[model samples]
Target: MVEFDLVAPRSADEAFAALRAAAPDGAAVLAGGTDLLPDVDEGRQRPRVVVSLRHLPWRTLDWAGPSLTIGSTLPLRALEQDPDLVRRFPGLAEAIRDVGSVALRHRATLGGNVVRAAPTSDLVPVLLALDAEVEIVGPRGTRRLPVDRFVRASRRVDLGPEELVRAVWFPEARPSAYRWQRVRPANDISQVAVAAACSPADRRWRIAVGGVAPRPVRIPSAAEALGAGAPTAAAVARAARAAADAVAFPTDRRASADYRRHLVATLVERVVDAVVRAEGFPR
Candidate 1:
């Protein structure tokens, strides 16, 4: 790995200034560093300067009316163990539980995972299904965007060179479920993952999938079908088939395209069924 300067900023302003000073060679923002450090060690990223957000003031969780705002630097382990978060956003908690091991989760930040934009990121699909929004601070000031659009493609995001993720916001929570297909129960990386959220009262639901494409995507056809009415086994099967057909799976070391397609169908059905049961869908 190349030698680079590491700057630990005590505040957001200092972090922003450091990033500006390091341009256009650019600086990598270090929060948790679970993903960035590995790439840096592998010589895949050679930033001239590394800005650490660990000392910054972005590591708190708060409630904004009906929404929950999670500081970007808040550790995944905190989210996993927060009783309020677990009760309100069970699906998100479940996804975070699947991220690496307990030790890794202790050092991984939710923002870091979203910014990494990897197809296999455990939290991305669940966040998308929950309609989460990301708050970012840059040279221009603060801005917010839907989580689904924040990640543009594999290992790519909408954040500007000097932008730093401040926090993530989730609207009112609803009944939700998540299921992932992995090679083993101990493996954190998923071959296919599905997240579903439902509002049985309104017959509205959302579904998103990851690890089957360049980026996590909402399965609109399946969501539409499930949201139209009660999701019976037949209806769930139909939605799963639609989701399988809609995803563009690519062959990867963990699994083949065909295998991923099958997993997507199966997991979609499983997650939808789980959510339906949790929501007590009418018989």
Candidate 2:
């Protein structure tokens, strides 16, 4: 392993200065270090410096009124059991639960997942379904981008070299639903995952699928199928199948593209049934 310096800044501005200094040299951001650390241990993320974002004032700077801002260091486990989140946005909680084992969740942060931009990331589908946005900061300033557009590639994001993720903002507490099913070994990528949700407050709905594509795929038509009116079991099943059919999934070791499509459809339908029913939808 090559030697590297670890820098911890007191604030975002300081962090950006450190990043700028390391830009010509090569430095990487460190949150909970769930994904990057693994690669580093396996000889992948070689950098001259590893900036410990731990020291920055993530709690204060991250909070934005109305829209909830989450720091990059906040644990996934924290999200899984968040009370306000469970009551206000359970769909995201469901997706967070499926991220990994309890231990991994304790160390994995939402910002890391968004910045990492893995196509099959568990949070992507749920966040996209909820229309979450990311706050990116660097030498310039902060800018917000839709989560869906932020994860446009399989393994790359839109962040520049000097950029460091500041926070993720949830503009509204949209009611939604999610389900992820996998037929793979432990710690392996998902075979098929489904997430769906609707904001009863505004009649906005979202249903996104993952595990079968480079990134989470959305089924707007399915969500549109659900107006303020909730559907029955049969209708839910049909919507699920229709959603699976809508996306052009890619094949992977976890499952065949054909099987994944079926999983996406069925799981989306099942989760929709669960969410709508859980929230007291009319039969």
Candidate 3:
């Protein structure tokens, strides 16, 4: 059996110190442990130490006017239950519901998902469409990066060894929708997911796709095809096709490249249409 030391720091400074001390030997950050625990049990990861963020004061959700901030350690279930969260960011709410079962979501966290940087993550695509930013705190101090820049690829992030994700920030609320195709709806991973949103401030649309290799990315060309608010059917089709052709889908055990391409196109169209209707755009 593999054995390792576990530490729960009471403060951010202590957390960083613990991480720094354990870095040479290898250390893994434990948030919700929804993913980390699985990796550890499956022998996919073997660290000398595991640093838990349980004692940190990061479980929070705050809204300032139109902007919102989600504390890193906050449980996904808590976020999903907030009525304002559902009303203000429906796509995000939909993605959160797709994460795992209720019991799993009770322990799963948004920060953990972002840090995991899984290409199949349901939340990241919505975050991309919402133009979210990640806040990080490290030995060098705190800094923020756009979600697009923060998530580099599958199981990879731009976080430093001694850094902790503090929170995720959204610039403003948006009318959005998220849709995905999966083997099972309850606790299975997505084969392909699409997130669509329109900025109330600018009336410009944002589109992003998940389940692609490397990472989930915002498709600027797809958004361009959408043009401004309440795109006509032709524009929506163009955007969907653009999204379908933009990404290089991976042929893995779960799905084929062609199947994913088709899913992306279909889901993109559905999500965009949903967002438009949700916003009460004229038919």
Candidate 4:
């Protein structure tokens, strides 16, 4: 592993300044370090200076009217068991539960996960499904970006040199449900992952698929197929097809593209069925 200097800032301003000092040359901001450590050790990433944000002031969760402001430093474990969060956004809570092991969850922060932007991130699909917004602090000032636009294929964002993920604000959903499934390859990462969410208030739903492409992605065409009017076997199949076609799955050691595509359809169906049952409704 490469050796680098570590800096811990007590406040956001100090952190921003430290980042600015190192920004022109590309500095890395460290959070819980769960995602960064592996890459650095494996030679996928190297940094001259690692600015640790764990001691910064971005660790509190606050309420904002119909929305809840989740701090960037808040751990996934806290998200998993927060009663208010569970009741208001069950889909998010469920997503948090599936992030990793209990110990990992206790130290994995939301900001870190989103910033990592891995294709298989457990929370990405659910956050995108809810049409959430991202909070970022950059040199220009803090700005809010939509969760969808925040996602890019290169696992990079528009964040400026002095920027860091500050928080995420999402409105309290009005009764929602979500479904998730993962096909774990025997000796590798997941072959495929499927997730879906439904909001009864608008009678609208979203379906997101991960682990089949370069990024955890949203399939607009397939989501449209799963309309709010009524559920049927035919509708399910059509939606599944769109969802599969929307992705450009590739053949990898985990699974062949064909296998992943087939599983995507099956998982989509399974999730849709589970969600319907969860809502005390029929397909």
Q: Give the alpha-carbon lDDT of every model.
A: 0.85, 0.76, 0.92, 0.76
The collision pairs in model 1 are none
Ranking by lDDT: 3, 1, 2, 4
Off by over 4 Å in 3: 279-283
Candidate 2 C-alpha lDDT tens digits along 1-283: 6578899888888888888888864888888888888777777778788888888766322324435777767888887777877766778887777777789888888988888878878888888887888888877778889888888777778888888878888886665677767664446567777777776556656888888556787788777766555775666766776786688888767678888877777787677776776553333
Count of residue pairs whose backbone atoms collide, per candidate: 0, 4, 0, 0
Give the per-residue lDDT digits (tens) of candidate 3, residues 1-283. Answer: 6788999999999999999998764899999999998888889999889999999999999999989999999999999999999888888999999998999999999999999988789899999999999999998999999999999878899998899899999999999999999999989989999998999888899999999998898999999998888898899899989998999999999999999998998998899888987743323
CA shift of 58, model 1, Å:
1.3
TM-score ranking, best first: 3, 1, 2, 4
- Winner on TM-score (2 vs 3): 3
- Among all windows of 10 consecutive residues in model 1, the one with the lowest summed lDDT is 274-283
Please give the TM-score that candidate 4 achieves against the real structure.
0.89
Estimate, for each residue in 195-270, the C-alpha lDDT of model 4 and write its tens digit: 6666655666678777756777778777789888346789899999988888898887667899888888888887
Question: Candidate 2, which ten residues in sequence have the lowest lDDT sum?
Answer: 58-67
Clashes of 4: 0
Error of 1 at 255 (Å): 1.0
Candidate 1 vs. true structure, TM-score: 0.95
Off by over 4 Å in 4: 174-188, 278-283
Per-residue CA lDDT of candidate 1, range 130-236, in tens? Answer: 88999999878999999988999888899987899999998866677889988886546898899998754465778999886688899889898775545767778
